[model samples]
Target: MREIRQPGAYSYVYGKYEEPIATVKPGETVAIYTKDAFTDQISKETDRPSQIMSNPNPQTGPIYIEGAEPGDTLVARIIEIEPTRDYAVSALIPNFGGLSNTNITRTLNEPIPEKVWIYKLEDGVLTNNKRLSFPWRPFLGTIGTAPALEAISSITPYDHGGNMDVPDVKPGNTIYLPVRVPGAYFFTGDVHGGQGQGELCGVALEISAKVTIQFDLIKNKSINWPRIESDTEYMVVGSARPMEDAARIAYAELIVWLEELGWDKWEAYQALTQIGELYVGNMVDPNYSLVAKIDKKYALID
Candidate 1:
């Protein structure tokens, strides 16, 4: 398995122009060492977001896949995510979060004070030390390939996929991304020890992790957005400005996937209206992300 380190190989943007840090062949598994969402700068409870004025989501690579080409689909199977640190940290940043006064949602109220919380891993669970313990549910918060045309920040999510922050991007799941450039430059990082549905605070239990993923190519398969497949469900992700727009995009893409599977367009829409479920990935990023999914058992029915 190939290894990509975080220190010198990380990137802050996703674009076809970014140089590839490493190269891997289709079907080869690679292990990436990723820093926390805080860019590995916050370790103790006393350390605040102010330390890093701009906490960029540093991505781990633009790994060039040997035969990936435009119009193909890149398949990434997450095999494992193991935290490399004993402690994780989260912060209440001044101008971030779903409820706080953000740049887009200006309000007269004062901004929330920057406060940090540190959680330590005891056994397989992370605890705040005072109370509240949950099992380690590590996942890659940002994972995607380069866009065909322009450069997008690591903080934004789009068809090329960036910091979607979805909790379902964990082990045992496969993410299918569109390939718009040669070699399909892939990058991933922002490992969260665990995150809730909306990631309300805009910060999760961030921790350094070693993530192992196997890469493959689906020749000539073109997809408008990213698709995720778990053992029991098929999910499609969409990111946009307004939350409702994000939902529409996700559902529409899911319907498109169903149409490809032989379901009539109208029938697929109706079926999804009744049985589809939505997963909120991120609400505070440059673009909010939402996922529309349906159980495989129900979707496969005639």
Candidate 2:
């Protein structure tokens, strides 16, 4: 059997992930065990938000894949996300999310039990709304690694990984992050039981699960940011001042990425402008996120 590594079980800061943990040629599978994104707090009965703010967003690993190098791309294909147990799902006041408008009086003070975390998002099924209740969709809130530059980033999303609370990042998804230093210093945290389009409330239906992933490398790709191929779509993750500016950075980078894939700059820009879509990944942190998606059918993957 091929050896699998745990992300939290090993030591890696910024410069350390470059060191190899285990060697794997192309097409090898490595299973990894991940701690809850909250690092171990907030379960089905525990709804206290204070505990969440205190703990760290402990990620799983920096499993050094053999042959990974700087300027390469580390493609992490999520095989499965197994939940150890159920947990509560909830939303908070506007002060908690990206759309924090002072005048908005509606706030989410209710702590939904783990069993009923999801609601029918349709039409009038819910008071004044009609929709069929749907099953809960779980995801990881924080899922990036160390920054090539100095300065410890808050557990929020940046070109480097922090608290990127995107919901589509689920099982059977593939995350592609640029290799700044060697080995790709990857980390993941803030797993959620469920979340909306934008993690507007700062947090998601937080929970922990065992994340199984397969890591592969794309050499000489020279990507400077992180991207993903979720089960349903492809996206680029970026954080910056003023949400629009951040989005610019993300899409600009995406354009460069497209160019590398053989599109001219003008064509790439036009395509992104016409068909690309944006998502508010997180707004609670100082920097905000805007993830853009380009249909996988239009792009090439090496």
Candidate 3:
């Protein structure tokens, strides 16, 4: 357990970066603490809009692992995500999202308000008004780490791990990230109780929360990109240009992964062609993400 003061530039959670609880053993559980996406604000029962601030996502840690090194894979298994309170708050700022660049030309569509609105899920729908529409699902807005290069990244999603707000990356899942630099400067924060795909409103149930995790070292799996495994599914994440292109890259990478894991290249290709699963992590950023997954037990293995 630790506290973070200034999360630095382009970070996800607010304030302090957290230190890993301990060297997580293969099946042991670890607990992690997190701040809200906004460093200074708290979820209050007010109807006012949050003041638009410079930084929205601040993260905790660069939790250095003792022997984590470059060319390695750090496997993180999420065990739990418990909210600190019953309900939380989130907001959408005027000029701080993927669509911000061209927002001026379409200001009317922009819903900037002096006060924020909170909606509730009414029978499988989000409704601030009893008559309006609803699209409600909840997820975290940021989960990532430092870049291999000397450069820093904003709290948004990148290969370095900032804000990759995907929906299915939740508790009881395993994440594998490539080790670019030594110790793999890892961090996490900006925990949302729930969020919909794309975070279209730019915010979710923002609040301070904690998580339990376990870490393991994948010895020689030289994967170039990130991958994840939930109890029921597997995902391969590729970040690159034009969503379709990135999606292709993601699938291609997974095929390579399957081959390297000892499948005959041709067989792996056939299997993937038959029943591989893929998803769009996010298409809003300059670099889109493609995630592919399959059940491990059923995945083609030699």
RMSD of 3: 4.8
TM-score of 3: 0.76
| Alpha carbon lDDT of each predicted model | 0.90, 0.62, 0.60
* Off by more than 4 A, model 1: 7-9
lDDT assessment of candidate 3: 0.60
* TM-score per candidate, chains pooled: 0.97, 0.75, 0.76
The global Cα lDDT (0 to 1) of model 2 is 0.62
Kindly list the per-residue Cα lDDT of model 1 for residues 1-302, writing each as its tens digit: 77878547467899888778788899899898888877888877788777764647888888899999999999999999988889988889988999899989999889999999888887888998656687889888999999999989998999899999999999999999999999999999999989898889899888989999999999999999999999999999999989999999999999999988889999999999999999899999989999999999988887
Q: What is the C-alpha lDDT profile of model 3 across 269-293, one tens digit per residue?
A: 7887778877665555445556776
The C-alpha RMSD of each candidate to the native structure, in angstroms, is: 1.2, 6.2, 4.8
Q: Residue 157 of model 2: what lDDT? A: 71
Best-fitting candidate, measured by TM-score? 1
Cα error, candidate 2, residue 106 (Å): 20
User: Per-residue lDDT tens digits of candidate 2, residues 140-171?
Assistant: 77666556766344355777656767776678
Better of 1 and 3 by TM-score: 1
Error of 3 at 211 (Å): 1.0
Clashes of 2: 17
